[model samples]
Target: MLRWRPWLPPLLPLLSLLTLLVLSDLTSSSPTAAPTETGAGWSPPAPVNHLTCYFCENVENNYICNRFAIDHPCPAGTTFCRTLHIMDTRGGSVVVNKHCATEDQCRDDRVGCLQQDHQKTCVSCCHSSYCNEPVPTNYSNAVRQPKPTAPTRAVKSAGAAAAPRLLLLLAAAASRLLLLLAAAASRQLLSGSRQL
Candidate 1:
């Protein structure tokens, strides 16, 4: 025996719409998805591919690092080549370190040198190969260069960055709408079944 219920017709449209929404969400690719970490404290950059840098650390002489720098491939998540030069103002000792670094490591460093209590630290970051070979110079009060601009790479515009956030917000709103519609439809079905 086959029985056709009148209440089921209204739910068909709602079920179809819900299925479509779910399918669309699953199919559409999201640009703002969280990136996989390569290793400890390493999130790969999107702008550049593999980078080769000079790796060395010397506490005595700045020229020794540049003279005997190892051409090393950067790690998966490291994007910039960093050169750190620390000068002890009291003892007149210079420490030079050139290695592959992440963006966060170079975030606070600027073009000119920064002086602390008794030591002046200068950190310079570059994107190209062997860019960190040149050791950072000592602090000079006369040289006041302007803030260095971002590296020559594809920088996302404000609108482009906001687009992903907007998509997520819309998706959330759609989900809430679907839940409310389902609840309303269920209540309607319950009342209709009770009457009959």
Candidate 2:
């Protein structure tokens, strides 16, 4: 037989495993359960989708590190601010030449503080709003209104102006006819009296 002593080291791991199995069966009728619920330490999988941040491209290779003053500042985890901008009002829409650290880039839009119409008309228009709000944002919210439309063309009525003249002319004609009738009646009455 080969030397059993020489094989002892190589077979030691196998022997220990077998010994454990035999002892486990003898000690308990059923295997003991984990101290905690099964799979207690496991966690849910990661999210499937994630939004990426935009970078400012207003200027050449300008990296967007901060948020613009408009809209919501760089979204919490936004990586960059793009050179996106819109006119808050009509006098002149803001143009974002420089990239903002935040998503919206504007100190205060030139036309911002005031309400305006598509024609670039301000709330200060005559017969409308008297350019009241010192600060527009809060004021606009308080009085939300629709944009004003263009004025319609009006035509003048010719008869309306000639009314007084027409009345004067009719009065003159009536008076002349009445005077002639009165004179004729008076003549007839005088003649009759003389004959009597």
Candidate 3:
């Protein structure tokens, strides 16, 4: 002989709903995952700090620049220190310009030393503090352009990306199943109550 519990029928639907909610929460992606993790395509924001550089302009010679260069802090968004050396072959004269430079400016002018008949120009860029203090007089020893920044977002692999979608789909399906079960359980409880 078996005894039917009157309260269990209604409670079954509530329990199933609770279980589905918990499962959905557990399967969801973490909110802070992108910021905390350094994946293949994810990079942290660049740190903002005072960047010091050797600053001068049209100093005419490397030795003069070395003696007269001022240590100055670069403005916001200007990361590299630059030195532009210009040599006039026919005139036997050298002109130097040193200043704080942005990455774009460095990239645009980093063609090394190019000679056009009687004149040669070279641009050097560096990131360390006072890196432009020792200006290069010629093309052979000039610094190359600074490297570009890392990408802002992470690239997802096929399987790794598919996993979250699969979990979401499973959760959605489970929710529907739980709702159907609740509907059936409610109907059974209503019939039982009506009979009583």
**Best model per TM-score:** 3
lDDT of each: 0.67, 0.35, 0.71
lDDT of 3 by residue, 1-196 (tens): 2235567666776867776876767675544334536455545555565678777788888778878888667888998888888888853447888888887777854647777778887778887787777655466667664554444223335556887777778777777876776666677767778999
Clashing pairs in 1: none
Q: Over the stretch 59-175, how does candidate 1's per-residue lDDT look in tens digits?
A: 566677777878768877887888877878763547888888787776754545888898877777777777676666655421222333665232545666677667767666776
Between candidates 2 and 3, the one scoring higher on TM-score is: 3
Over the full model, what C-alpha lDDT does candidate 3 score relative to the true structure? 0.71
Where model 2 places Cα greater than 4 Å from the true spot, the runs are: 1-157
TM-scores for the candidates:
0.42, 0.24, 0.45
Better of 1 and 2 by lDDT: 1
Q: Which parts of model 1 have CA positions greater than 4 angstroms off?
A: 1-49, 90-93, 109-112, 138-196
Off by over 4 Å in 3: 1-48, 90-93, 145-196
Clashes of each: 0, 10, 1
Model 3 steric clash pairs? 41-153
Candidate 2 residue-wise lDDT, 23-82, digit = tens: 444445444544445666544443332223232323221122224322232334222222
Worst lDDT 10-window in candidate 2:
121-130
* Residue 91 of model 3, lDDT score: 36
